[model samples]
Target: MGTPVAKIGLVPCSGEALPAGTVCRLACRRVLDTLMSGQTVAICLPLFIAGGEEERGFAARHPTITVDGCEKRCAAKATELFSGKPVRALLIPDILAQRGIPMPTRLRGFGAEEEAAVQAVAETIAQAVEGVVAQAQAQENQHGAV
Candidate 1:
């Protein structure tokens, strides 16, 4: 039988105080539900931090991408602390700042600006997932060739 494809875990920020946190969650949802779909799995930050064995075990087995809302990097830090280091880490504020997009202010309601941010972040996550998958496939091929 052929080797099974590896899945990438997505860990999004859980902070509700900042609107950027909302963007992180929304963007990750878009990637999980639409953009990357079956290629990715969502890792709940709260559950991971709270010692969810299943969550931690999946993260430990698969590559992970952590999306953080701010500089605190709670998601990234927690994932690293519990399950090795993540394959990729993304910060929404840095992405927005680099792209000249302002942070969304509304926490619950999303406007055009928020939607744009979500799209951008989702695209970024998709790209990261693609890279991780490609690298894994290459490594698998190389090992199979041996």
Candidate 2:
């Protein structure tokens, strides 16, 4: 096989697409936008929905940023299982659960309240990534000045 390309990946778990809901996609986009503000996020497009070939392609390239819409945490688990420690992870259900936002059997996108929940999750993940980057930078600075 050829050497994997290096890119930044965005992954989301939407719990098997529903009739006409776009919560997962929208939330994923928000997360991507936030991450993109700090780093390059290669548009991998729905990594959790892809199959073996596509999955391998994504895993082979890009440091992954995974976002899951449920407790199942499919995106994060897949990232850990195949790709190793994801650069970033957002657990949507965990975030919502923490905020006492119950998941409806059928989601019709997020309301203002739910949107806040999603933003909180994404922001938390973004902050974590920023922290990691800061630590890496600190280490680099120390080494460079040595």
Candidate 3:
């Protein structure tokens, strides 16, 4: 199949109420700024939740991943409410717990453990982006890119 490059949108929780939320933000930044800069972009959750037409329009076209902080899944819920379904959903707390990484209680007092969690989460997100892009391209090629 021919290579069909696809844009990926990352919507981070960006919640300041909890440290997991902060980790969500940092992990997304790692993806957008370092891991998948060329293939992915960050979608502002504040504006998206506020019904920003541009963000909504972007989601309509690209595959989006919702990076949530806790089990509440605010980011994922908001995205689903405004736009269509997200291609994938990530939870920082869940990831950290699954990886056996302990997290800080405060929102801004993260140390090395938090950093490590962010790194792990970012790597997973990057890999997910590649898979989504590749699958989209294969599907497009099969369907003749209508």
Candidate 4:
């Protein structure tokens, strides 16, 4: 059989109080469910923090990308603390600011602006996943050649 493919873990912030947090979750969902699909797996921040062995194990074994709502970087910090440093960390607010998109206000009242933010973030995550997978494959190939 062929070697197993590498999967990237996605850790999304669990801050429900902030609209950016909602964007983080939605964007991750898009990446996991559609954008990257089988290439990525979702790691629940709360479960990881609460000592979920499965979540921690996955992060430790695979490359992880953390998506934070704000500068607090709760997801990134937790993943680093429990497992190892994430391969890539993304901040929703920073992405929106860089794109000149305003921060979302209401969590429930999502509109075109929110959709745009989600699309941008999801695309970014998908790109990151591709990078991580490519790097992993390169390393595997190098080692196999030895």
Best by lDDT: 1
Model 1, residue pairs in steric clash: none
lDDT, residue 91, candidate 1: 93
RMSD to truth, every model: 2.1, 5.2, 2.7, 2.4
**Residues 16-124, model 1: lDDT tens digits:** 9999889998999999999999899999988876869999999988899999999999999999999879989999988888888888897878877578888888888
Off by over 4 Å in 4: 1-5
The order of the candidates by lDDT, greatest first, is: 1, 4, 3, 2
**Clash counts for all predictions:** 0, 1, 0, 0
lDDT of 4 by residue, 1-146 (tens): 22445688999994899988888888899999999998999998888757799999999888899999988899999999999999999888888888888878887677776798889889988998998888878877887888
Which candidate comes out best when scored by TM-score?
A: 1
- Those runs of model 2 whose alpha carbons end farther than 4 Å from true positions after fitting are 1-8, 17-24, 34-63, 102-105
lDDT winner, 3 or 4: 4
Off by over 4 Å in 3: 1-5, 144-146
Indicate the residue-level lDDT of 77 in model 3: 86
Please provide, for model 3 over 1-146, each residue's C-alpha lDDT reduced to its tens digit, 9 standing for 90 to 100. Answer: 44355679898988988877777888888899988999998888788767699998887677899998888988888888888789999887777788887876677866775678778788888988988988887887787955
Residue 12, model 1: lDDT of 96
What 10-residue stretch in candidate 4 is worst by lDDT? 1-10
Sort the predicted structures by TM-score, highest score first: 1, 4, 3, 2
State the lDDT of candidate 2 residue by residue for 1-146, as single tens digits: 22322345666665566311244556556656765454535334344345555665665465566777666677778777765667677776666678775544445645664565556566665665565556556766777688
